[model samples]
Target: MATHTTFQFRRRMRPHRLALATLAACLGSGLTAPVCAQDAVQTVTISGRNSANAASVAGFGDIPVSRSPFSASVITTRQLADAGIGGLADITRLDAGITDAYNAPGYWGQLAVRGFTLENRSNYRRDGLPINAETVLPQANKQSLEVLKGTSGLQAGVSSPGGLVNLVVKRPTGTVRQLTLGWADDASLGAAIDLGDRSGAFGWRLNAAYDHLQPPTDASRGHSRLLALAVDAQVTPGLLVEAEIESSRQVQPSTPGFSVLGDRVPDAGASDPRTNLNQQPWRLPVVMAGRTGSLRLTQTLGKDLQLSLHAMRQRLDSDDRIAFPSGCSAEERFDRYCSDGTFDLYDFRSEGERRTTDALDVALSGRALALGLAHQFTAGLLFSRHEARFNRQAFNYVGTGRIGALVVTPADPSLTDENTDRDEKSTELRLQDLVVLTPEMSAWIGLRHSRLDRRSERTDGSRPIAYEQSFTTPWLALSHAVGPNGMAYASWGRGVETEVAPNRSRYANAGEALPALQSRQIEFGYKHRTALLDWTVAAFDIRRPTWSDLGPCDSGADGCVRAIDGSARHRGIEAEVEWRAGAWNLRGSAMALKARREGAADAAINGLRPTNVPASSLKVQAAYNVAYVPGLALLGFVTHEGRRMVLPDNSLDTPGWTRLDLALRYAQRLGSRQVVWRAGIDNVANARAWKEAPFQFGHAYLYPLQPRSLHVSAQMDL
Candidate 1:
């Protein structure tokens, strides 16, 4: 016999809420929740289960992963804890389609999905509401992270065609009290607590954490603090309200990447990867502080109609300072370091930078029967506003510094002044319908009409720029059930992106707003799920316009003109699998990509591969419970990345690399309390390799993989 937990809800409860409770139970205790509704009350019984297979990122509603038309993945909090993931960049090890895009240590996260870089302004969400991802996002208060691959025109009006990431906030379930203590190499320490309870129709959850980080680097140290609160109330039999707020602060000195020495990639032994080039005596650590809040209200209008309203606000303040290195003395190749490993050093400082974002959404959904066919529909209106203020930055070249040498120059006395301001507002109307044509076949259609207004100005007596644009995008998909647990689907989608002229004096139309560019994606996929195995395979092709400098002007104020001159086309195939049977668990994902530039005006770059995107990648993770020990498990992880092009012409590239990791886990009950311990060693073989080499702003950077390190943690239920 197995123990069971039951939850009871009052009359006329929302189905989506019930599904959420079921998912929570599945994640919390590895149990399955089967729901049964009565005339006056509904009950959910939880028993033994294997996995949680439902997610809300697809936007229609809480749908099973096997039924969704698009490719998606969900990373639960338990997975994060087991892998010791601390930031967004660390998630790349779990998914092959995700890769770094200038993701430096101690800085905000930046990544690419399917060979396309994600736009920071419109590619992130929190509980279906837009939120700025420019600052370090605290993951302690998040229940799960959801990744939706491909065009999301129906969900987000203006977004990158690559994909979108959504963070789900932790909500109050039943009673929960847990504490976690963690440690890593170099004396890093962390502590966190989670508390939740329910009283009558109201419930609340609180999360708090603090971390002191001393990374395996020279003269680099940091600390962070986070606090979050979530609450919900069943105000009436047909109405429910929920709210959440979080505040976090982080201070750290950013590590700068190494540059190529002239036209050649430098040897790994040229300089110690642990050396922080920005470790000047007068340098200050980067400080980022942010607060976010959201509110949601759901009302049952009728037996088949429901209305929902969501609103969110986010604000971030940052003080950035660094001793940056760039360029060489040679005029021919100024973007690279000199042959003797010497480069120009600059004192860069930017303070009093503020960013704010606010979003609101109202939606109505219902199910109906028309023309003898069942239909599920959603109609929504969205509004969002973003604003940014920046102080005058200082980027002054100080002196030259050589690799493996310390040279400190006097800090410049220049201070910051208010200089730049930018504002953007967007409005969108969306409609979606899912029609069941037969018992085993369905079609989904969606449309979004979006309008954007943007303005920017500089206090340095420059011309201000403003623009207004509108577009309509469409999404269509058809899915057919192959069997009881398998489905195949094909989808096509269109999206839009905004572009601005680079703010450089060399460009004739610098800071000017350009016409909106459109992007398109076509995908075919199949998904299967069973009691012990789940798998998905997808093939996708995406295309978007690329902007570059077209013609060079004579030596005058107008040096050049930049415009859209080409298109970037990316085709890829990706597959993911998960299996759990007896005492063994395995998960793996693989991707093969071919990304190139087409129809380019510049002959040198035509038909060339994009920078920093790998041709192939693979990731796998496994855990096995000891049959005799009863309380111990063994864990292992492996990752491999194919060679990545470093230059647009594909003349320079980095070799493929492989990494291996091992860990152990032990769980036991002592005196009516549950305790778990985890220990892990990353990069066990201590392989020296370049993780990524990205070219940005005319400079080439080489980011190296971290050396071997150790991590340990303990968790207790109180």
Candidate 2:
């Protein structure tokens, strides 16, 4: 990995230069520039709300969440800080509809929404622009995180039917300077600084952070650094230009998961939670670095019309290394470990892996009155290109290791093989409209046409694969205002996804590409809001085609064939509530899901529950301001997850578990500056539980929940 330092450095500098050039061009335009007013005074407000009242993730402009027709939620910066959230896995504690999906320590975050795993390439966005989600995303410079649950065909052309996550970048709000210091019981230390200012039609914001993280696991430690900048200029009264760029790097070793022994689940208390299976002396830490830039231009065409253009570029380079553990020495049984706690180990390493993404979008939005009806509409065109380059990886078998002993496996010395590259291009045209049918009723309709081209090449003498596809997805919804503070709505949508057969020797039709599959979703929901309370309830059903390996190939060989032969249906209900009064604040959410396979070629798997999908989940957070202390508050959180099926055949499962967290905060003024301090303990009871069990690559892996730990932080307005 270190051999490409020069190349990586040169590649990383291009985005910075491009961003600077764009800024210069925007400033040098002939448009007149005027002096702007001074920054306004800042005020503080205490509320129980976890997010803003509106969001734009649904691609219908900034609409009130209470009336948006789909289920959505937002987590604000204040909420994130209060809960000490560091990654996507922690976010599951705030929303019942989201859960973990193979998210391990020191690796990029992965999650599922509504019983479906989100695609890393298409289901994530930054400031409404697409970016690669294959690396660690820094949260120090984020304003809010928005989640849209269910099908998103209108918002994204090709995506998972589960949902999408959009990260809102922090903009230049006003003049401010803040500094923070943090510490954790696991020997982690961090510091951050945020600065922003505005002057005469121009504003800028900068954020930087550095951290040294040491998890509870033995011989596992890492470091991370980040730098981000954002700027905006009001070119004229009706024109605005904004740009942002960020660079970050992280080096950490990934932890391998535990597996079941024979037919029995591993004992939770047998090994310490701090045990790490990948702690071989010859193992190397994974290195990940990324750079991203974005630009936006908005112009007001008229009183009721606006035009906007957006462009984004991202590049990621990573070296993945791990001492992977799988299977056992038992004959005819390679899916689980042996009864003596022995398993086969492999020295795996893949270097010089690169992923890049580029996207551009142009949209027009306005309001009009025609045919005796008021309408709001948006029309847009989107284009995106993604490429991935990889070198043949090393997965040589090493000596076996016992659960409680140190393993000294020698590193593989084989040279890397030829390169493999994948390229994907997509174009989409979208249109959506909201029409007021009556005084209390409205209708929403949307449509999108997408074309995708994908190609892959292997330099190791393997045949190339390519495919082209086109699809049209439609969306419809109807909402009726029950009262001034309540609304009821129903929505239906369709989405598309592309699948390719694995390039393995066991599959007869290996490397074959299939046509895009379609997924459908239907939902009904209601929302109500008041000065002191807000609540929402929704029910949804989603269905999609499932692909798997069926025995007996067309070649008359003793191998399997890969194709779509089944369907998966997921039905669920979700509810959320928030209440704020004089001294107490409460927020909670709950979800119930039923996911099963149907119409399968194999009867043994039909009607079985999907792996890692929970039947029900609940989360709640409460805070109270002490009446006598005036500046002190206490906080508590509770979360519960139902049992989950661990295998495709429904032969193994993990039990349900509940967790509790407690915290406290103190805020006061130091002279003319504001100061705040926070402390929290997660998993206070020290209960050991299996968090998630995901079967991958012909093996089953079990991840344990984090042990009890304490963290503290302090911030000062300087």
Candidate 3:
């Protein structure tokens, strides 16, 4: 296993020397405080488990921007619950940069940052360590989610500048069993069970989640299941130990066909409901499924220091078969296919679609203050290693319609033997520290020297050696409170990314490997929180990724042409808000972004907006416990992203859309009243919707959203 660990963090001050101070208050009064004292500082959980007002400047400053040079929006467990969210993507879509990651027949999503690009980290994490699939990890008993939105030079000193996202899973609490069930408009149903216990020095907890739905919109059906278990114990009064394991599986089939207005329609037989069926010409054309299992452990050493260790194995499998449209407008419009041709390529067999990724990681965080240094600080070390492999067999048919009516165009099935396997090992040693320069201002500075050693051994096992590619990055930030809960700051950093997976490169069967890319950025942001409101707004400019295309080149060129003078500028604003009063809570976020690159063949276009990068997006939701009833509540959520470019031509695009989901819950005693029954509705608007990506192949061109449905369930609390 290859690993990266950083150990020393003593450096001269960078700038804006100031100390961080915290206070407690809500935003309802819309009040502001310019300067606060340390004696007045307090600690309150924004997680919403219990209502207390505490000011955490760490959530407000611009000075030390963690890993990304861009701004970040951190949503706590309380924030997620208050909004009544269901999945991981549901949380990620809360911000921008990420385009829809759904692919194949299932809602198997691949997360993207800035654009469709991601670094080796793939943006996956659990309690701060890698949990596998870099894009999206199954949300099982999750507690909080943090989005790092720009060039990542700090948190991941060596990773894709694309960005980073951290998911904090739930841990075993001291005591209690909690159960809840919910229903939504558009036909969404769900139920969850949570149990915890702490006796003397031992504690344990387990949680399970289930969701079922038949979309209100055309051809949309989705269902999900998840479970998480955790164990904790106080080996000693001041020392604690903890471990956790989690698993989840989500299967969502596609109804492929949709209307021109972005609604569901019948491309196949009218017998199929446009609102709840996939319209692929071939029956059982495609299916996708994502399953993950993870194990993690944590141990506290003492009062001033803590340590964490975790490992997880994840897998993604897909089987996709698509029928090409006979008369596609794009084909005719572009003159790529014969207009009067007797037969067109209609059937494609992309069989045995499979991808598996496994990862191991360990890290430690501690508190320390250097002698003679006039500041309090935080220091830590982390290391991780991951492996990924994918394989697929291709097939084709001569005719369309029923399989029995077509002729199998035969080819060497052994071609599948050509599949490639590559093992990448990376390591980093880092020592970063936060410094309190003065009572009014604080400066957080960190320097990291990291190396990524990688090798691509053909499926055949061979002697392994580290390809030493080492680089150093510096992170610095400065911030000052403008008011009690508001602060402004600026940051700068650089980032790195591994070449696209070697498997993808070999899929094209080029005899070589692609080189990794690098990116840089500068950004600023502001934050504030009061009684019923909290938000962070910021903007950033990121340079296009720079790297050499490692694919094979044609005659006439000395080497693979450098990707068309590749470069672009990304700038945008992001905001997150939460408002709660009495038993009602409302939450949401907005992102406004514009990105472009230099125009060149194979190179992303400059004038053309990048695919998956939307110009505007926003989400808002509210949930309230019933006022006139006992153990009852109501929930609603709405999320949307604006239009975006889809094809290289730029003019071809995916229209923007917004969807609203409403649900109700009723908790009442049954029989002896020891158990409670709960029920509700989903997709109140049952509004038809689809995310616009994957339109290029013209196979299964669309992914439809779920329709409105009903759900009923029961749970017991002890």
Give the lDDT of residue 483 in candidate 3. 58
- Scored by lDDT, model 2 comes in at 0.79
CA shift at 24, candidate 3, in angstroms?
Answer: 12
TM-score of 3: 0.72
Error of 1 at 667 (Å): 1.2
- RMSD for each of the candidates: 6.7, 8.2, 10.0
Q: What does candidate 1's lDDT look like per residue over 1-718, in tens digits?
A: 1111111110000004322332232222221232222111111111111124455666766555667688877776666666667787778888899988888777787878998888777899988888888888888899888888888787787889889988899998868776656567777777777788888899999999888877787677888899999999999989999999999998988888887887788766455778788877888888999999999999999877899999999999999889888888654566677877888888888888899999999999977778876777899999999998887888877888777888888787385443668899999999998777776778889999999998888756465788888999999999887776678999999988887886678788887878777889999999877667878899999999888786665565566887888899999999988776777778889999999899888777877899889999999988777777765777888889988887767878888888898877666555655456677888899877888888877888888877788887555544
Give the lDDT of residue 109 in candidate 2: 74
Off by over 4 Å in 2: 1-52, 413-419, 503-508, 553-559
lDDT of 3 by residue, 1-718 (tens): 1111111110000001122232111111223222121110111112341112211212222232322123655566434443344455555434554655443334434556656455334455555554445332555476556666677656664556667667666776666566656555445666666777767788788888776644444334566677778887777665566666666655454333332221222222222223322334343434445555555555666554555555555555555544433323433432122233212334444545555555554556554456534333334344555554545433343342221133233232232333344555445555555454443355657666666656555444432233546677666776655655566768777766555322332234233334445667777877666666666677777775544344455443444433324766677777766676766766667878878765344544446676546788887766676657755666666778887655445655656777765555444544433333334444456655555544433322345444444445444433
TM-score of each: 0.92, 0.92, 0.72
Q: Model 1 Cα displacement at 81 (Å)? A: 1.0
